[model samples]
Target: MQIEPFTLHVPQTQIDDLHRRIDMTRWAEQETVDDWSQGTPLAALRELVRYWREEYDWRRCEAWLNATGQFTARIDGLSIHFLHVRSRHENATPLVLTHGWPGSILEFRNCIAALTDPEAHGGTAEDAFHVVIPALPGFGFSGKPTQAGWGVERIGRAWGELMRGLGYARWFAQGGDWGSAVTTAIALQKVEGCAGIHLNMPIARPQPEDLAAPSPTEVRALTALQHYQDWDSGYSKQQQTRPQTVGYGLVDSPVGQAGWIYEKMWAWTDNAGRAEDALDRDAILDNIMLYWLPAAGASSARLYWESFGSFAAKDIDLPVAVSAFPKEILPTPRKWAERHYRKLVHWGDMEKGGHFAAWEQPEAFVRELRIAFGKMR
Candidate 1:
């Protein structure tokens, strides 16, 4: 598979359309949900919409992202957008970084500099890495997967190919959220050149009772898993069952689009209500616009159905490290992780950070990355 390169070019017309939609937004009543639990509140959406149109600057944000060496690549018929940041030193470890739902390569914004240019970021020059930050197959500029079989595991293969294509014979891997699971797959499945792996969030689901003894903690994990099914997983259900139905609403209104995307970000982050506590306002909007501009709000959701329907996570035999945060919805205990990964190390109770650890806490994020993967280097 060959990769493609793209100049940073966001058209002016799209920007106008987004602002126009924001201006024309007809908001709804705030049916009270004390916090952001129900969804993005109409009040907050209105305020954010106003700021996006009046205060936020698209070209400025685009310029910031453009500095990261963003480019496009074709692998197995998919066009992938990725950041290929090479280190100054020779023999730098290559690390493939992945992002999750409602996230982009933006999650790794702070960690990227630290990982690639370690010496500058207060690390040993020996800890340098050539980082590969890919836009997930359907999520961003990579374009959507039209045919079947582009589940999480297949995405893993595409990433491994991406790394090898870049000429890294061996590399380390790290991720948070869905990225964690994909990195998990890469490490477990023995992707070519994957030396070791690290994750902030663990790929978690209810385990069969017979597979291992369920501790009270494990039982609590199960209950939380079940609660997601009963209460919090409406997005998964809609995405899995009727994505197109929701897509129509998302495709039309930027306010509606904000509500759909922002709520997940709110719930997933360690913040109380403001995602800005962890993410930049423009950064959050950029992720939403990636979906809105591509009109991929529906197609991207199909990934949930695609991954869940067929390729579930397997018991992987690889060196794996996981950093579980307090707000992590999928808290895979060490024992549970041990059952799956043959070589499990570096499991820690993160005092801060939520699903998007790289975005939330980059220094601590880099510190953890250095601890787990710095060994490989």
Candidate 2:
């Protein structure tokens, strides 16, 4: 496999065009309700748009990514973009962190330094990790898959190969959302050199037998799942059934793309009132740009159409750790997770955090990872 160094330098003309679009946006009418039940309110989006056009700096984000170190490797005929940050500690373990839908490698940016240099971030050398954060195929800087079959299973296999290709004989994997599904697949397939896995959003569902005598946690989990399926799953449904249709609006309209993802950042995060409470305004916009600038709205959504239904909590006999964030779209209980992860090693219930664990709560995210993987080490 050939890996080439990559840097992000969006053309000046494109940046100018984005600003022009934001300036000329045909405004939508304000919502009747002051809350987010309908969707991203026009008032909030207007404020975000104003800030985005006048203040948010893409160069800052680009520079940060460049400084972090990035490369693109052709794996299985597709170019894969990833961040490779090696710890100075010689005994650091190799670990791959995967991002989910509506997220990119940017999600892990804040945690990288802390994770790779634990001694500098209030930890001993034992907690250090050689981190590899990859952009899922058809998202961010990675090449889009032109054909079908690039599902979680294939991506898992590719990750396994990626680790070996990078000269790591053994490595650990961690992820949330779609990334969780991919990580589960990696463990299920017994991917080469996969020592263990950790998940923030595990796909553990109660079996009929288990549900027959539901505990309080199981009941709460089932209720939450039902609520998600009823209200919060419109995006998933559209992405699963007709991604191209939704992508047309998302790719052509910058505001459309921003609204699509921004709503999720708000709805999913453990915020006091606004999404900005949990995440920085600049950070939210930065993540949206990863989709907008790359025009990845279609390709990214297609991953769901390809693999959403195929994901489940299959039994795996490997060291598994889970951090069950309370505000996740669907929080799995410890008992539910233990059913599928036969050799469960670590299980933590985080007080705060949501779907974007690494981005929303980096300190907690890093702490969970170090503690969880500590058992494996």
Candidate 3:
């Protein structure tokens, strides 16, 4: 497994082509509703597209990623891309942070400097971590899986190998969204040298017994889950059922791709009312570029088709820590989480943050990881 250092450099032709496509976008009719009831509002998206074409600098994002250490390794017959930032603290615990669908390593970029050098970011050396942020197979710079079975379980196994390959005898895992599912899979598999795992969006589901006599939190959680299934799950359903069909538009039209993910950024983040409220435009664009530059729309969504139903957390006896973000698509209540995570070591209900916890709330996100892993460390 040869690991090679990587850098970011999108071909000029590709950038030119993106600009041309954005310019030639044949827009659809605007929604009748006053708000985001339908999807990304046309006016909002038009402004974003304008900025994306005229002002948003992909080169800056590229340079930022290049400055951060990056590498690609052949793992499980696939070329996996990851950002490996070692902490100055020699004894820092190794940690593998994974990103989910509609997300990439960009989600963790802001937290890297803080995590790897805690003292530099207002924390002690004890809080430092040697962080490894992997672009999930079929996302960002990672090679797309040509065959099936590159789901959460397989990704989890690959992450174990990745940690070992990087010379870490022991490590911890942290993630949210699809990342949470992958982390849970790692815990369930009892990956060697995995000290523990931390999750922002835990995959605990209300069991039949719990639904019979639900607690107040469980009732609220269940209601939210139902709402998600009814409304917000269209993207999941489309991806699970016909990723190839959706891929055509997303891969071809930059606007189509942006709209698909932009809506989620709005719906998922704790942005109060708009995505820009919580996350800056550049951060959001940086994330979108991960998909746009790589044309990973279909490949990223295929994980849903492969492992959506299989992601639920089961009874795992390993030490597990969970941080439940309030505005998450479906926040897992502590009581519900306890039912699945047998040795629930840490449970936190954060005041703010949502699906993109690391991106939306880096300070709180870093603090949670430090606190959660401190117990195991």
Candidate 4:
């Protein structure tokens, strides 16, 4: 693997073009709803557009991100962007931190400092770990795979290679959303290079044995799934079948992009009313900008269409830890996940974070990961 510096500098033309798209956006009519429950209410998007065009400053945000040791690696012919910050602790274990779809390397920015140097950040030196936060293939600075079948398993294998290329023989892994699925693949294969695994968004689809117990926890988990099937899966359906169609609106308009990203942030965070209360608005815009500048809005969504169905069928063999947040659409019960993971070690029902736990509550997320992996140690 060849490592090199990676940074973004959006040109004047692209910024102007983004503004024009924002100006020319064709608004779709919809009834007033609570915090974009109805697919990014057109009105709220329009307001967001104003801030994005006139108020938001991308260069400043980029500079702040660059301070965190930005770099790129050509892995399997894809250019992968990541922030690598190693702990000073000589005994710190190498850990891979992977992010999911509709997200970027930015998700892990908050936890990097604490995870890498726990002793300096009010944590035991024994809790330290060398953290590798990689942007998934095609989501950000990472190269977008142009062909098909580049699923979670492949990504997991790539991660294993990434560690070896960096001269590490073993590592712990953690993921959220698609990242969780990738961790499952790495763990199931018992990747000799991987030592333990932790996940936020479980990618193991339901199995008969998983639902067999019918315990209160299992029943509640099933109910969540049933509800997700009814009211929460519109984005998945579109992404799976015709991501290109959905991409057209998202790439062309800033408001459209904001709405697309905002709905997820709102639905999946530890927030009650204002998303800003939980997620930094600037962070949200930075993620959207990654999609907008690359025009990868559609290409990324195709991940769902291409690989999710098959990936959902396999079971993981390693010990796994899961943290479930209340507002998430289909949070699996701990007992249910234990069926797939033979060595289920830790489970947490979180009151403070949702889908993007790594971003919403960095302290809690890092603490959980340390505790989970520390047990394996």
Candidate 5:
């Protein structure tokens, strides 16, 4: 349970090497269709790669991570890297935020200021939080698990220990994507200090009854879920089935890694056909850098291999809150969520945002957390 300071300092040589790899990429032929029906467009990827090689400054991102207060603590034989930003408000709640696949701790950068200093970010002092954003094992600067069994359930247990080690007797938890699975696992385990939990991508699959008698929203949700299964979940299938096979290319080529993630950025984000519409080029590159810098293409994918099926419904008695972003992978209804989360507290059908709720919409994300956790407190 010992905590130690961690600083991000990517060596100059390593950065230079990344530039070389991007320069030497052997790009494939462009997609047949003009749109993104096939995969990442060669033209778009090349444009992104051009910027990454020529102008994107890794050092700038490195400095921000350092200044944001990074730390490492050993738990379950792995050193977990996290950003611990404590609010000045004495009564601020301690909250643990988790990131999922194709994402890193960088996802929460914009959210830190608003959560840690609510007054400065259009909120009263009472809305403040002592935020802890942890990089999931095998992602970012966190130590990769050499052995197996480091899935969501184990991760949930480790988070409990992490908060306890940090001297947080009472706290709230929030997550999206795979993070939603972990936070739900924590609730199922009934982690002692966790007061309540919040989720942006609440994983509640539709039952027979739901399908038989569906509302307009439920019908739309069902259609979206079908679309994901039919078209969008190819990445998940590959990662969960053969992460190592995909890892070889991702780990070797910078463009390969970028293309792998860039596709999701385009598909998942709430944009008008381009990821750039929702997230800036620099921001997208910042996220891709985490995987590239760590060479975590394979290791990060292992979480899917280990816990792909764990996103199923579970009876969780702990107080739960959900924010169903419009373009989330599967925006299930409140009635569906209430089936699994017995003591549901808050349900927000957010007008905007997508799968990466916090990253895509930090203001809305912060507002959800403040309102959701505010109820429990």
Candidate 6:
């Protein structure tokens, strides 16, 4: 594995072009219902885009990426971008953190310091981790797959190779969203160096009997699943089936790209009416910028096309930990998770947070990982 330092510096012209696109966007009529039923509301989107063009600072984000130890390595002939932040504390555990859709490595930015330097972040040095945060192929600066076959299983193997290449003989993994699927793949592959895995979004399906004799937790989980299948899964369906078709707009229009992602920020976060309740306005745009600047709209979406149905229950015998946020897309019950993760080590039902756990509540996310991985260690 040949690795090299990578720095991010989006050209000023590109920033200007993004602003130009926002200015030229053809406005859509306000939704008939005043709610987010039709899509990202026109007034709300206008306000966000106005701030994005007039006030947001892309250079701050660029500087952070560069200072954060950005690096790239070619794995299986595809360039993979990652942040490698090693803890100065001796014997710090090697931990690879992966992010999912609508999330880039940026999702874990605020967590890096607390994770790699726990002593300074209200924890003993014993909780320290040497963090490796990788952008999934085609999602950030990572090279897009020129052909098919870059699904969860393949990505899992790549992560294993990446860890070994970084000289980590024993490491733990943590993830949510697509990251969870990839982490599960790593555990299932029995990757030699992988010590244990933690998932925020544990994908354990309900059995016939479990549904027939439902517990309160089971009922809530099943209800959320139904809601996802009914109203909230349109993006998944579009990406899974016709990524290229939708990419035209997402790639061409910055507003289109922002709205596509903003809706998820609103729907998935533990917010009170608006996404801004849970997330910073600029942080949201910073994430969207990753997709827009790299023009990764279609390439990133192709991950769904590649691994849509791969979120099934797995009989993983490796030590596992799970944090079930109350607002998670489908907060699987511990009983169901235990059925899949035979050696379940930790199960936490969080009081707050949603799909993007780390981004929504970095402190809680960090605490969960500290406690969960501590059990494995």
lDDT of all predictions, in order shown? 0.78, 0.92, 0.90, 0.79, 0.92, 0.94
Give per-model TM-scores.
Answer: 0.92, 0.98, 0.98, 0.93, 0.99, 0.99
lDDT of 6 by residue, 296-374 (tens): 9999999999999988998999999999898998679998888888899898889999999999999999999999999
Q: Per-residue alpha-carbon lDDT of model 3 for 288-348, expressed as tens digits?
A: 9999989998899898889988766688877899888888898788877888888888988
Which candidate leads the pack in lDDT?
Answer: 6
C-alpha lDDT (0 to 100) for residue 337 of candidate 2: 81
Q: List the residue pairs that clash in candidate 5.
A: none
Of the pair 3 and 5, which is ahead by TM-score? 5
- Write the residue-wise lDDT of candidate 1 on 250-331 in tens digits: 8788888788888777777788668777678888887787787777787777777776543244576667777777667666
Local lDDT at 332 for model 3: 83
Candidate 6 local Cα displacement, residue 255, angstroms = 0.4
List of clashing residue pairs for candidate 4: none
Q: Write the per-residue lDDT of candidate 5 for residues 204-227, one digit (tens) a residue.
A: 888888889999989999999999
Which of the two, 1 or 6, has more lDDT?
A: 6
Give the range of the ten consecutive residues with the poorest summed lDDT in model 3.
Answer: 310-319
Which consecutive 10 residues in model 2 have the weakest lDDT in total? Answer: 309-318
Location of the lowest summed lDDT over 10 successive residues in candidate 1: 307-316
The TM-score obtained by model 2 is 0.98
Query: lDDT at 27 for candidate 6?
Result: 81
